[model samples]
Each structure stands twice: as C-alpha cells, then as structure tokens.
Target: MSDNVYIAVHGGAGFHERKYEKEIKHALQRACNVALSNLGSKHSSALTMVEDAISSLEDDEHLNAGYGSNLTLDGTVECDAAIMSGKSGCFGSVGAVAGVKNPIRLARAVLDHSSIPSPIGRIPPLTLVSEGARQFALSQPSSAHLVSRESLVSPQAEERWRVWKCRFASSDPSSLSGNLNDIQDTVGAVAWHESDGMAAGVSSGGLLLKYPGRIGEAAVFGAGCWAQEASDVEQGMEMACSISGTGEYIIRAMLARRLGEAFEKGAGNSDGDDPHEVLHGVLNDQFWNMRRGRGEPDPSVGVLLLTRENDGRARLWCAFTTPTMAIAYVSSKNPKAKAIILRRPQNITLGDDKPCIYITGISL
Candidate 1:
C-alpha cells in the first residue's frame, strides 16, 4: 500500500571458500545494482525487476542459474525456473529445461501466456517439465529463436561437466544426489513495487550431477517463493520471501510459506522476538535439523524476506545456516545499495565490521 519499491537477491546458500569471496561479493553487488536501477525507474515493475535481476545472475558465471548451472550425471545441462505474481496468485514454471538462455524469462512468459483467455475453454498448464518445456518455448510466437541448447552450455559448465562425470563414474552412485558441497545451490529474488505489487522468482541448475528429471523447490510454488500485500501490517500480510539452499530440505520443510506464516503469527504476539530470531529458529532449529537424524550433514538454508511496515516503510531480512550466503538489497528509501557476504548470523550486530544485512528504511 505504500509507494515504495524494494528489491533483494541471493546468489546462493552454500560452501563459499575464502578463495571465492571476492567474486561472490562482486556478483551480489552487480545483481543488486541491476535490480535497484530498474526499481528506481518509474517504468519498471516488481515482476520485471526480479526477472531482470535473476537474468543478470544467470549471465554471471560466478553464480549458478543459467550459464553457471550445474551439469547432470549424464553430462547434459538442464535448468529449472519459476515466477509468481502475488496479486493474482498466478504463476508459471519450467523444469529440466535446456537451450533457452534466461529460463526466468521463459517462466515469466509462461505466466503471461496463461493469463490470456482461450476460446475453447482451455487453460495452459502452470508447470511444464523436460522436453515438453523446451517445445513450449519454441512454440511461442517469436521470429528468432529465443535460445539454442548448445548456447546454454558455457565453457565453465562444460568443464565442470567433464570433471564431474569422471567423479561420478568412480564415486558411489548412492551418495551423489544430495551432496552440494562442491557446487553451490540456487539463486533467487523477492521484490515489491508500489505500482506493480509484489513478486518473487527463483532459478537453478539444480545440484551438480543430480539425478536427471529431479525438480527442486525452485520449481515448486510455495516452497521456493511467496508474496502477499498487507494493507495493515499488524495483521501480518505484508511479506514476500525467496530462498536459495539445498532444494530437498527446503521442499521437505516448506521454507518459504512457513516463514511467511511465522511472520504473520509473530505480528500479533506480545513477545518481543526479533525477525532474525524467528527466521533463524525456523531455518536452523526446525528445517536444518529436520534431516540430521538421517546421518547426513545438515543442509544449509538461505532466505530473503521483504516486509512493508504499517508506517510506510520497507524492510529486508536475510538469514542462512551455511558458513556464508551471498546477498544484496536496495530499497526506494535507501538508494545506496549494500552487499553482504554473510558469515555468522547469530553474532551479527549493528556496529560489527561484518554487520547483518537487515535494513529498514522509510518508504516512498
């Protein structure tokens, strides 16, 4: 209800060794700047802003989305993407899609194409996977081909594929699917525009050498992203969230929707628990540990929450269970964007050199 546009993005939530921090930081900053620049202009809506932001990440080989996407065990590239519009609850997604450059744009195109009425009382499918998804993209009314399959395979990704294929051949096949220690997870964005409402989008190459046809949380509606407009902040509808981490844990735990519900319930509680506490408790104590009994290392979860307050203000909250999560954000009220390579969330404070990325500024 406020005339403010907010944008936030995450490169991933995973093991980022010290060696890759500088490049990761630059990627986060670049993505944030692109999103903010679009959000600042009157022409851009939240949907387009997020689409553009994720596209930028896809282009950057440092992060996983399009170009840097992980390869499958069979040495092929398949990607998944989804986009949602909070106003209508209308969404579209493509999974295990190969060829198209920006899968996020294809996801948006699906959403847009579905909104048009068909004379024969038919509605387009909300989600498409595998070869079917690729056919759909090719069928769209466009003169030039939107993407080529070979173009999707970047040199970096191809090299990763060659090396991972050798590793897959020698390693135990049973232990390969869930391990993401080597390759980073998904990338995503959640945003709000005063004129265009709220939107969220997520994209991923999926875990490296994962089983073919495996669909992660990013392709699922409630697990990967969600948004709602709140006329009254006290009543709890003013939140949007996007996530990047182990797809399995996020899907099993229902991270995005559950986080939104937590924010809603926390709004009416008299207890003074902060947003960070609520987020960390849900992510670490509930979700991360949920699968620990299976004798596997606790998978990390990274999240971004965008809330519009009662007093015409917007706030962004980011949290992750990994050693570091790459994130960046900017709001209409604060034009100077800040990028954080998050390390320890529990010990973060306002004055620390590596302070938390949480920000609340007066909205336009």
Candidate 2:
C-alpha cells in the first residue's frame, strides 16, 4: 500500500446531547479503528475501509443507522444506505429496508452485483427498496444477512418511538419538533487509498415518526454520498464526501455531488480553489438560502469530505449547518484516530437571510 490510506466517519449532524457525548465520540473513534484494523490485509482498499467503518457505525446504538435507528410511524425500523466508488463511478443503494443487520453491507452488495454481466441484455438496478432490497440481501454473502426487524430496534429507540408516536397522535403542532436532543440523522464514511483512489458511503434510520416507506437522502444517488477522481489528475483533486441532515432538503440540493462539482470547477473565492469558501458558498446559496426562501427557518446538514491533491496530500474537511456534528479520522501514517464533536459557537448569530454554517479543515 502506498501511504495514502485514510478514513473518516460522521455520527450525524443534529442536536447531540452532552449526556451521550462520550458514547458518541467513542463510537466514532471505534469506527475509525475498525477501518484501519484491516489495512495489513493485502486486498484492503478504500471501498472495503469505507464499508467496514460504516458497518461499525451501524452497529453502534448511539448512531442512527442499522441498529437503534429512528422508528417509522408504525414503530418499525426502516433504513436507507448507499455506497459509491470514485475510481469506477459505481454506485448502489437500498431504501426503506428492514430486517438487515448492516444496511451498508447490503448497499455494497448492490454495488458488487452491478459489476456482474447480465445473462440477458437487461439493465441492472442501481437501487433496491423494501422487499426487493431484502431479497437482494438474501442473495449476497453472510455479511449482508437479514435478521428480525425488531432485533434492529434498541430499547432506547423503542422508548423514543413510544413517546414520539404518542405525540404524533395528539396532533400538537408544538410537538412536531420531537426531541432534538435524541436526534441523530445519519452515519457515513469517506475514505481514500493508494490503490482504489476514493470512496464514500452513508446509512440512516431517517426521521422519527417518518412515513413507513419513506426513503431518505442516504438511499439517493449523488445526494447522500459522492466520490470521484478528476479526469486530469495531474492538475486536479480526487474527492469523496458523505452527507447527513434533513433528507428531503438534502436530496433536493444534491449536496454531495454539487460539492464535488464545485471542487472540480474551482468555484470558490477569487482565488478559485479554496475548499472552505466552496463549502460555505454551497451551503449558503444552494442549501440554506433555498430552504429559507421556501419559508423553512432552519436547515440542518453536515458534510464529511476527503480530498487528495495532485501532490498526494490528503486532508479532511467538515462543514455543517447544525448545532453539532461528530467526526473521527485516521490515516496509515497516523494510526491513532482522533474524534471530535464539532459544535458551532453558541453566540454565533443567525441573521434573517444569512447562512449559519461552520467549516473546518484537518490535515491527514
């Protein structure tokens, strides 16, 4: 392996309570460690590291993915997940699926299946949903195995669902906000390897009391995750990004893919290559402003991005419009991963039409 291997993960972008801070940070750190643990294997690549890291996040009850995901209106755990490869431009997704142990694994399976030549002249599916997704899981390896739907629901999630469901039945407009403290939107990972270039993946349980068959940004192409290698690598950057936030707004914005395009076109400031400026511009013009213009006062979203410059320097960038976003990063040179819960300044004022976004860069 060439020394460019690295992975970063996010524990969602929303209101994270201080009480669960330790658990959330530990979960993100564990995911980074999990991704790096298999680096010694000869076949490890960015795709596998992204998968393993997200699988670790999915297993953590502190996250809103495979296990402990938000419950649907019917009190069932339905999930959305997707994975993409920058080198090959291969993409796969599963939407509103239940009974799967690791939704990201199933999404990876979908991606792998797309590579197989069809017996006939038929097109393969880029996404699978509901029962079709579960059926597809059955055909994959044991890693994508299915379990009881109830087994995926944690006690805490169930209690949250019970309370939320009661509030929903009351039809109280004030209760629409639910419990922001317990809201964890999505979990995702972005990775880069010398051999495979870059890859990104995302998984989510979706919003509390969401419709039974609702699919979130995690299951949509170019919305939840995007990874791409520049055509002119000698003068360009390879990038991968995973997003978490309000699924509807995110899906409409196509935030991940748009960011990749912005990086490619150098659409930042007058210098035209500042990643930080690009992030702020996109969040302001494309996301926050659009939502506010539509009469939505608040728009929540977070992006975890990995970029490798032509000179082989890798950096991690995180930008969010929410109260907090949890992230962790580790590289082969720095095997010890660092996890941080990035919180916007409490005193940061939100103007009537101005964007309230925070952007940070970390050297890898």
TM-scores, one per candidate: 0.84, 0.96
Q: Give the TM-score of candidate 2.
A: 0.96
Please write out the lDDT profile of model 2 over residues 264-283, one tens digit for every residue.
78732353356777788888
Worst 10 residues of 1 by lDDT: 353-362
Which parts of model 2 have CA positions greater than 4 angstroms off? 1-3, 174-182, 267-272
lDDT of each: 0.73, 0.89
Clash count, predicted structure 1: 0
Which portions of model 1 show Cα errors greater than 4 Å?
1-3, 39-43, 141-145, 172-182, 231-234, 271-273, 284-286, 293-295, 345-364
Q: How many backbone clashes does candidate 2 have?
A: 0
Deviation in angstroms for 120 in model 1? 3.4
Candidate 2: residue pairs that collide: none
Candidate 1: lDDT of 308?
Answer: 68
Please give the RMSD of candidate 1 to the true structure.
5.2
